[model samples]
Target chain A: MRMPSPKQTLAKAEMDMTPMIDMTFQLIAFFMVLLNFAETEQDARIKLPSSELAKPPEVALESPLVLQLTKDDKVIFGGELLPISGLGQPLSREKRFLELNGVDPKEATIVIRADGDAKTGVVQEVMQLCQENDFEIFALRAKQELAEEEP
Target chain B: MKLRNTGELSDKVDIQMTPMIDIVFLLLIFFIFNFRIVVQEGDFNIRMPVAGPSAASIDTQLPIRVRLTSDDEGNLTGIVAGDRKLDNFSDLHQFILAQVGNDAGPDGADNMEVELDCDYGLKYRYVISAVTAISGYVTADGHIVKLIQKIKLSPPKKPS
Candidate 1:
């Protein structure tokens, strides 16, 4: 008689990937919702002062130009760092660029993001320079501070 | 009827999950690296044209003069609003509130303008605080009661 064939006891182990896929898609969705693409130019060197009344505007500003002021009295415009006095060239360039696009320099809003420790005089000088450049509309940026709840 | 039986199971199609999982993990890593926690920012608008004599004369009501002085280290030393000397920002806020009542209209006192005269060495944060105090205040109902809608900065004084 033929030898008894050895018993075949192989089992296929297939893990259920449905739950993992579901979780991964959910994670992707969560991240997608939280992703901000506003292109807000922020600098790590400047610490903005906080204010309770500083509420984000209801409507977005028209033609905003951001000027970041470092505590050391330097201005960061379009990624180029320059002293307050050196800002004239860049300001004129920006004004010309705006005019080329048919946008009045006065119509553009200059968003000033100055360091909390920066000199108030320097901040004023920056504003004056912008004013001289005919960029009149100014917005001094401040971080939002939440008030404590009253019992 | 006689039938021939072929031993077989159901046909199963195995999808390749390796490439898909690889792509998904890459996307997740991309998003993770791009994630940044940014603080919320707001603005205190100041419309200052080139300071001309005519512009100052145009306004019938005199702007409230706010003077902020500081020491050599840029620490606030004193706050003077008009003729009154204020101890802190809260006093300045109250002074403004008293001057400009909580009214919003074309003829309301909210049209009052504040002219900030900051010392050369004053810390910029104090200027922001002064602006916040004069601009508006948040009420208990979470509504922002705007006081003075106009603000201007005095020409920078000589460094002391």
Candidate 2:
């Protein structure tokens, strides 16, 4: 048998790190693109009702006003919690703001995020209040219900 | 010490990669920690002008009324579509499908509207289910065929 070469024994073991670094960079890029920094106006207190027909709108809503209705019938708008009765003043303010900005309150979308457990009456009341403020368009927000797996 | 010639340079310049790899790993970890798998949310749009029935277009016909009633605990008790009583949402969907059919033109569903008349004490989930039934149904292949695009609410009844 031939003896092993001394040069081969003396050489340091090296790993080709190019492939690993390339893969790591690819993963980082993938995450960077998918990262969502936009803060959606969602409140944890309201557990939205789920519906199979509620697909996301193809066209983005223009200047939507998000209102979260808690189970207890309180409305959360612009980070302030108020009773359904007290929503009129804030709604008026909102209408005025829209007028000042030259946007029609009728064109503005009021997105209602009502709790699944909330009373239907309260949701209607909120809608009525929005109508009083001349906010004609309303979007009832619902969680997307995942389809059940077939056997 | 013996001095090497200044004119002679090494064939390969070893660039240190440890710090770069460390920083890259930190970034990956940060993103992984902050990564959130958010459930998708959707909306049901309804145009209800301040002016009650007068807001409706003159050409459009009367809206079909679907009533939802509930018990004291807010549980859904009954569902009525116009004059017919529906046992459940599926029944309501069938009723709507029979009425609307496939007569929708290229512009989508007809100009028909569905008015939701829900009881004050009813849970919102039932109302959503009713809306889901009235709006549309997803085919087996996951395609959504819209039924009625125009939906409005009837005047809310007082909670008993």
Task: List iRMS for all predictions.
Answer: 1.1, 1.9
Candidate number achieving the greatest TM-score relative to the actual structure: 1
Tens digit of per-residue lDDT, candidate 2, span A118-148: 9999899999999989898999999898666
User: Which has the greatest lDDT?
Assistant: 1
TM-scores vs. true structure, each candidate:
0.91, 0.83
Candidate 2 segments whose C-alpha is farther than 4 A from its true place = A1-17, A146-151, B1-11, B101-109
For model 1, residues A108-143, the per-residue Cα lDDT tens digits are: 999999999999899889988998899989999999
Q: Give the range of the ten consecutive residues with the poorest summed lDDT in model 1 chain A.
A: A2-11
Report the lDDT of model 1 for residue B13. Answer: 83
Candidate 1 per-residue C-alpha lDDT over B1-160 given as tens digits, one digit per residue, 9 for 90 to 100: 8777865666988999989988887887777777788778899988888866445337536788999989889999999999999999999999998787644556555457789999997899999999989988898888888878788889998664
Task: Give per-residue lDDT, candidate 1, residue B152.
Answer: 88
lDDT of 1: 0.87
Alpha-carbon error at B1 in model 1, in Å? 19
What are the chain A TM-scores of the candidates, in order?
0.91, 0.78
lDDT of each: 0.87, 0.86
